[model samples]
Target: MSTSLAAAPAATSRRRAPEPPKRTAAERWKRRGPLLPALLITILLTQLPLLGTLYYSLRSQNLLRPETNGFAGLSNYATVLGDEYFRAAVVNTLVLTASTVVLSMALGIAFAVLLDKKFLGRGVVRTLLITPFLVMPAAAALLWKHAMFNPLFGMLNWLLSVFGVDKIDWVSQFPMPSIVLMLTWQWTPFMMLIVLAGLQSQSTEILEAARVDGAGAWATFRRITLPHLRRFIELAILLGSIFVVQTFDPIFLITQGGPGQATTNLPFLIYQTTFRAFEVGEAAAAGVIVVVGTIVIATFALRVISSLFQEET
Candidate 1:
């Protein structure tokens, strides 16, 4: 009876658990205090610039001659909306943005798929692959325009000469394509990194499950991998579109917003308007529009994508 009672007490003790230690105030503050200050700083930094931009967007103050400036109630906005140049800029910007995003996503996915598999010299290939993205935009543009597409002494022309082909003017003949291709080359690695991250994050068990269901490789990708990567793909597009819309260096360096303003994007247009033409109010208005449009689109896309990830979880 004594042994039985001792064994019963031991079993009861095993069933009970010790209480977790309560956190002290200092410990709690240590964990969350830094985060609160960081969040406050982030909000202030972001909001202050936006508020200043909004203020400038409403005023007609030339940086060179502020004495002649005054408040313009929506006049700048009206002018920006009514101008043909602005309309063309909007279209060009959209096209460039779309082209960059689609091309980058496609090529990034292709390269990621290729790179995901083990291969010889993969390290060298990876380094070579990302070299273009790391090149300074100005240097890249200079090399493309002066050395690769200069019509006469350009490497592209020299290569074409092998087939008895004449040199073609890359910027003049295909202004938008040249800009699109250049930006695409520079930004695809951004997408590639995102896609590869997504691919690596995919659940191996889910893939095995698909394989056990007699799914082919294509079917497995369609049924499992793509679904899981929805969030990452959205991230790629979100970031890619924002940067593409604001592109300036390649267009400015390679084409100078021309062969007759053909390559003039929103950012380039803003620069030309404010710095070259001295239209400060109009340029600020343009900046405001670009910022608002970008924020709205990016926010909506991110929310949708975050919901997708949430649904899976």
Candidate 2:
């Protein structure tokens, strides 16, 4: 009886002792332990500038006179919104964003489609196509502003003169268009590369089967390829729009926001306000507005992307 009781106690004790909780989860987590630190650091570094901008937007702290400081709440925002130059900047930015995105996507998709087909010098063509994206923005801007659009001294005017056309100052007559052209030249390759990646992701078998089913090229593209690349197209548009709206280098180097504020974008306005006019508070306000607008658009774009990813899965 004592032996049976002793055995019973031993068995119960063994059962009560928790099996060393499964080690795999803990081991896997330990392996991934660096992820949190990296994420936190990334977030901190990325958000610090924005946080500072937000802080300064609410206070009137002009560099020239720091003593007349006061918290103006949304007064700075009101001031920026009511400014004529600021309005022009916003309008120009929107125009640039729309035109560039549409043109880039159309041309990019066309270029990608052309490149997708096997042909002579296909590799060379791709290399050439991607070349513009690699050009230094400053150097390219300088070339466009001076070498190409210099009216009497410009290549564009020289070319126009060959056809008996009068020389017109590109900066004065077509400032926004000139900026758009330069930006599109720099940016279209980006859309092309992304769209091509999406194109490559389509299954060869599906395309073959479509061809076997008597589907024409247009039908295949519209019905099969376009549907498949919708996500990528959206991604390209979003990326291009983001860059176009905030484009600084070309505008700075070429237009300097001028010939009567025609091509001045919000970014330039912010630069002019803070740096040139030395209105720190107003610049911060512009910065906050820009950040908000960007965030809103980005959120919508990401939501679409997420939906597409879900559909793809």
The global C-alpha lDDT for each of the candidates, from Candidate 1 onward, is: 0.84, 0.87
Best by TM-score: 2
Residue 64 of model 2: what lDDT? 90
lDDT of candidate 2 over 1-313, digit per residue (tens):
2345446423334334444434587775895798989987887887887788888899887989889688889889999899898888889999989988888788999999999999999999999999988999899999999999998799998998989999889988998889888788888899999999999999999999999999999999999999999989988898678778989998899988888888889998899899987899999999999989999889878876777665554
Task: At residue 232, give the lDDT of candidate 2.
Answer: 90
Q: Using alpha carbons, what is the TM-score of model 1?
A: 0.82
Clashing pairs in 2: none
Q: What's the lDDT for candidate 1?
A: 0.84
lDDT of 2 at 257: 82
